[model samples]
Target chain A: MFDPEAIERIRAKQRAWEARELREFLARQPESRADCRTGSGLPVERVYTPADIAATSFDEIGLPGRYPFTRGPYPTMYRGRLWTMRQIAGYGTGSDTNQRFRYLIEQGQTGLSVDFDMPTLMGYDSDDPRSLGEVGREGVAVDTLDDVEALFDGIDLEHISVSMTINPTAWILLAMYVALAQARGNDLGRLSGTCQTDILKEYIAQKEWIFPIRPSLRLVRDMIVYCADHLARYNPINISGYHISEAGATSVQEVAFTMANAIAYVEEVTRAGVDVDRFAPRLAFYFVAQADFFEEVAKFRAARRIWAKLMKERFAAARPESMRLRFHCQTAALTLTKAQPMNNIVRTALQALSAVLGGAQSLHTNGLDEAYAIPSELAMKLALRTQQIIADETRVPNVVDPLGGSYYVEALTNRVEAEVGEILKKVDALGGTVKAIEEGFFQREIADSAFEFARRKASGAEPVIGVNKFVEPPEPNAVPVHKVDPEVEARQIGHLRAVRAKRDGTRVAALLDRLAREAADPGVNLMPVTIELVKARASLGEIVGRLRQVWGRYVETPVF
Target chain B: MPPIRVLIAKVGLDGHDRGAKVVARGLRDAGMDVVYTGLHRTPEEVVAAAVQEDVDVLGISLLSGAHMTLIPRVLELLRAADAGDMLLVIGGVIPDEDVPALLALGAADVVLQDTPPDAIARRVRELVAARQPR
Candidate 1:
């Protein structure tokens, strides 16, 4: 055993040698001063040593799967299993999307992610007068459980994980999923998936909300409690920053606003008398990995550290699982360019690499044609292959947190945390995220940021490769755009009409009436009634319209 | 002249509204009245809003690739409401091959995101001008 003083002396000498080498390297290229900054614009330094990490202790920044899991939530991480490969799927009707789902699974996709059409997301039926012409056009339209049953027809509920990107009426969709699982004879406890039931972000970024803030929050809490009690494997709320970042918030605002919303959810559910440890474990997050490689990496790392710390300190979660912030990521669709559409493949691949390196549990890569339209099958295959290449070929996941402890990355991580901390404080001061959203704080911030990014692109400060710089005029004849089935709407409407004509209309009406009464009951959880309504073949518009009758639709009161 | 009132709505389940919001804001900035009927609006609601607001134009945005289906329904609603005089415009991630068909189906014009807001506004003004017989 060596003496402590001797060991200390050896370490100091080693540090001095590294400094000397770095100084010599920098001196050789004096013009290339290693100035550093985070993706969110916070300044960073070229080097960090004991002086920088002096305050961080073993207790504060512990080992993987330990308290305050700054490094990672899992012990083995990707060494044991690769991140879940979930490609966002939905197009045409439920049956069409169902086939796509089965195809994706056969192609080695580990999980399923559903993209709903505008009418479905807005809680309208396929045949709703307003929903006409739009059914299954943008995404799969599911007006009733019949559609949901068709969407997951061949898929075994117990085996595959599903993620539904629906909000506002998330409870309705979740009910559909549960009913489908029940019909399949799968134990609800065994079935797993995620509902992006984040209402605050809906107000902040997506704007697909139906109820006013308080009631919307009540519904969110209801799902959290219900899922925690019933379907323990399911992720109740996927607190999302993807839309926020895509909608134009900077990386810092994306993380800050997302965390603020997450905090709001935590506070609300806790206020509703649910124990934090019971449900926090299943609470997942969805974030965007943008073009900024290292910054995006740092944001992910910082998010983990901050969330773990919050869980331990703020919520006092006893379970390590509760503290572990499991997240799913998708490459930023906003960063993809319609000009040089091919470049998007590279853009998506790089963003996805950042997500894996940053330790995401699940990931989706955007198709190259996303900026132009819904991705053609060819483009989608390429997107899936990009993730496969990164996983199998790159060997990036060979080491856990491969970019961990890099001077630039660590410094960037610290800077991002500092900036986001300031934002969180502001959100907290505004009486939390709900009040801030109601007051239009988050929306105003995103709009301003979006405007800035656009202005920057126009002024040539931020270069958009094909859009601004390196412009190449597209050839007169490029790839033919993918054609959607023009008859899709007519066909879907016909099917819906037949379903309505054949189903006992009186039974459907009675079920809907029961739903209306249950929704009106403040104490009554609407999920059960929603399940009954869906089982009775009640359409989405009727279900949401009923709730809308009880809880009037939200009118945005602009906070000036 | 009173502000050029425009009603914007997403007819189907395409929840992508970034373009819709940007265009709404741009039109508002361009001294036009903009009312965004948030996602999943029915054609009936849109037509009623157009009739009630007496808007000069209706701009519909869809990213759900459902514009082909959704646009015709909105047009039919307009015709039913006898508000066909109000110009109907559409935009979103539409395929170039589908543009002519959408126009033929009664859309005054199909604007893509790549097209500048000013160009779209100018087109709106032109349609309004043409409707007035010079």
Candidate 2:
């Protein structure tokens, strides 16, 4: 091995050379003050050297697949396997979405990610008056087991992993997924997939929450325990920063707040009498990959390191897998533009590359038309192709943690780790993430960051390619956006009504009542009851509304 | 008079709300009273909120590739209640292909997702200008 001092001296010389070059360049043309801040508004120095990370050691940072996995989670990394290719999908009725799912699988997508309609997301059935005109509009409308079965009609749960992006009714969706697998003769224990059962982000970022915070926490705890025991291979909750970033938080806030939410989940599950090592391994994360290339990459590296440390030190996790942070990344939808719609392909390609370089286990590249509408067939194909190009053509996956020893990247990773730590401390001081949410700390921080970001743009401090800079007049025909079937609502509602009529009404009612009673009892785990209700063909509205009755819905008191 | 109350509800499956939230903040900053119903708000809930809040305008945001089906029902609800005077504006990831139909369903105007915040605020003001007569 090379001498540590010798390596330090070489790095110092390179830093000096960079500083000298920067000085010579600045002497010719002054750099803008705004050019110095990272995308998240953190100040960037002209150069970083060994001094920047003097406190960090090789062991604390560690090698791939080792303790405190700052470099990479797996020893072989992409050499063994590349990140799973996933594209977010759902629209029209269950049949329509099922077709799309089949098409995606045919296109060689390695995994599945389910997107639900607005009515279904908010725990409403297509037959409800409130669901009028909304069914199957944005996502596949799943009101019952029939709809759920239709969604994955031919897809095998045993072979391909699936991720359901629902929170308020995550348990219902999980139950539906389990029932679908069982019907196909797959054992519940053998199913592999993840549910975005992260209620904190729903309340804080997405605002798709159904129950109050405390009860929601209990529900999440129940899923963790149930999944640990039965669906050992399945992930119950994928705590997400994707929505938070999409909602306008900076990269630092994205990682920080998401880590805070993850901590809350770990604490809740631990309190529920589940071992940390049992569920922590399956506790996946979802983050957004944005245009801030290096910082975005650094954020991923820091996230792994922080999670590993937290799991080992805070939770006392025994297994290395339990401490490892496996994540799925989606290119930032907010970065796409409607002006030059096709340009989003290039943007997504760059963001996806960053996530890979930072070692994401799975990725979804947003379509070029994401800024304008739900992705069309052509646009989504382009999105999948973007990932294909990177994986097959670019040879980026051939190396493991390729950016690991760079001075700039290491410094940035350390900086992000420190910044996220500070944010974690703030959340902790507020008596954990739940209390922080009640006190509106997370919301306030995000708003403040968003406000500052907007102020920067307005003041010409930061640049957005299509928005602030590179002004282009709107094109007459940029590209046509996708239009969901107009009759989808009526058709979906009809199906839902038919199913309600055909199902055993007495059994459905009894199961729903049992779910309500179980929900009321904090100690009672609602997983088995929820599974039975979904199996009994109870509507999404009935299940969610029962919880609403027992654990009154939460109303947001906007903190601004 | 109290600030012109406007309710922004997201109907259907559109989760692209950066535009909606930004518009809501812009309107709120512009001194308009805004009640953001958050994401995935059902038509019934949105209409009930509009009726109860006595909102002067109802703005619905949808981008889930589902506008054609969702927007018309919201308008029909208003028309059926004789609350059609409440200036209806639909925004968020709206395709130009469906703009005419949305406007035909009593939407005063359909705001595209890429429309600037200032333009959205200005359009809402124009729609409610006569209604907010002193």
Candidate 3:
């Protein structure tokens, strides 16, 4: 974005300075390492100047809220209204998690994000044998409409935006949510929330899949179509890179794989006769704000620019809202340490700062105690306070895209965008995301990256302050670990049984039969019938089981 | 001598297999025959596979907080199958307090999160060596 003559002058001056002053300093003191690299293994230069970003054009790094939104998504980002502070909370029964939700809201959390337990996430009811000790261990267990109602017991659904972190059973959860709203007579058009129905990421990174690839994509298409028609303000699918990053992908792979999956979704929906602008506006994204501060910021900026270009040129989405890439970011949980637990607080604060500086629309700062288990109440409070401190005290948000024009950041952003383009080209050559997934391409890439990172840390090349460097004696019970009650499984199962015993079994059966019949037909959207099945008290397992009978389950060949 | 056979299994619905896969590859690189059971395998399925594969070491990797209930069940089934001699090594997000109980329940060792893969491979070698006839 600099004038060529100005850049040439700057380059000549930089070379002269390096030759004279830099040579003497380096000869005497020398650099710390032979090479410095970001977490993605991108080389870091000793300094950056106008010459670094000389090749970039002004239009590519346009103003906020404009096309090629490399700066930020909005004209007045956090200055207008701060990013939503959403701490994902779940463990134990729905009511148990609801209490935590209310506690977070009382503690100044702006938005709600639900974390479903394995059973709920995998489409198993609390009573299913597969749900055994896992009913509510990792997250809240939702079996039916009653559990969902209890999960949101005292919360106002209209005002607060909700994000459900579910994949395989996301459509069922959406149905339960819509059923809850419909039963409460809340306006469907006013429901603002996001269902992380991005099933492509499941095969790529998360490893949480129910139906096979094509069928899963079909379910995602059904959700997008249904939500675009009904839930006006709700995001039907949150195309996510968060789990991909958490599963050991580099920041570049995270964005590239997620975008490839997004492209696949857009293609799937459009091929099914849905308009691009119709559903694309409601499409949201989720990414991780990793520990590399400037790299994370540059990654977010590059991600937004890549998405904007994709929407404007590739998909032909006309609406500005369709082109604008809004994302929610969570601080890297893998960075937290089980060794010096308290150090995680500082780590989280800095990571959250990077996310805010990157202009995330919503953010989740991980609890310091997350390395052990679901975080304790005190840890969650500390995590929330970290966000509050950044928003109120840091003054980082006063200017939109504070690091927008930094030569280093701009150059890094361009580099990240280029790397993502290369990866996407590979995904395309493998015949798109599903084909690549079937070929185990994404899985192998992530596994290799994860191994490389582990090797680096193990060899002391990559230093984790509390893990490999400056180690200390294990502090037993340094932080209170949030323990899900052992009796949660039995109680949750009893609740599921009560609901089943009270509801009309025949009607539930008929509704499930209709669901299976409709699921057998590729032309039908399953959301409407699924909602009816949930309203009739068909458990999450029941609905998913019927669909499984129709569509079949997905099993992956081991990659590693 | 034959290479030490290692079966790294994810014995629950938890999908956090990054650690498991890395450890599996690390052990494989360390010259062990490692087989990963992918994801979503139940405790019964895990035990059955351990027996069927005739693995020398059954490494159970659990991050879902279901270890307290699931690990013991795997141990119990191994005993019932008369394969109690197989080395049982636990890994992933186990708390410090739970380590003692797990060890007391006949677990050869409990490797907490971020223990270097090379260290894990060394420990497995020691355990296998100890199990051999003197």
Q: Which candidate has the top score in DockQ?
A: 3
Which of candidates 2 and 3 is the stronger one according to lDDT? 3
Q: Each model's RMSD to truth, in Å? A: 4.6, 3.1, 1.0
Instruction: Determine which window of 10 residues in candidate 2 chain A has minimal summed lDDT.
Output: A451-460
lDDT tens digits by residue: candidate 2, A1-112: 3367877887778778768986798789887563577788778877676666666677766799998888788999989988899988999888898888888888989999
Instruction: List the candidate 2 regions with Cα displacement exceeding 4 Å.
Output: A1-25, A32-35, A458-460, B1-17, B28-60, B64-89, B103-108, B119-134
Tens-digit per-residue lDDT, A340-433, candidate 3? 8999999999999999989999999999998898888999999999999999998998999989889899999999999999999998999988
Error of 2 at A442 (Å): 1.4
CA shift at A549, candidate 3, in angstroms?
1.0
Put the candidates in DockQ order, highest first. Answer: 3, 2, 1
Tell me the native contact fraction for each prediction: 0.46, 0.35, 0.87
Which of candidates 1 and 2 reaches a greater DockQ? 2
Q: Which docking class does model 2 fall in?
A: acceptable
Task: Give, for candidate 3 chain B, the lowest lDDT window spanning 10 residues.
Answer: B125-134
lDDT of each residue in B1-134, candidate 2, tens digit only? 57878888877544555666667777888889988886666677789889888988898877655566667777788878778788888877666667887777778888875455666778877778756452
Task: Pick the winner on DockQ between candidates 2 and 3.
Answer: 3
Better of 1 and 3 by TM-score: 3
lDDT of 2 at A522: 92
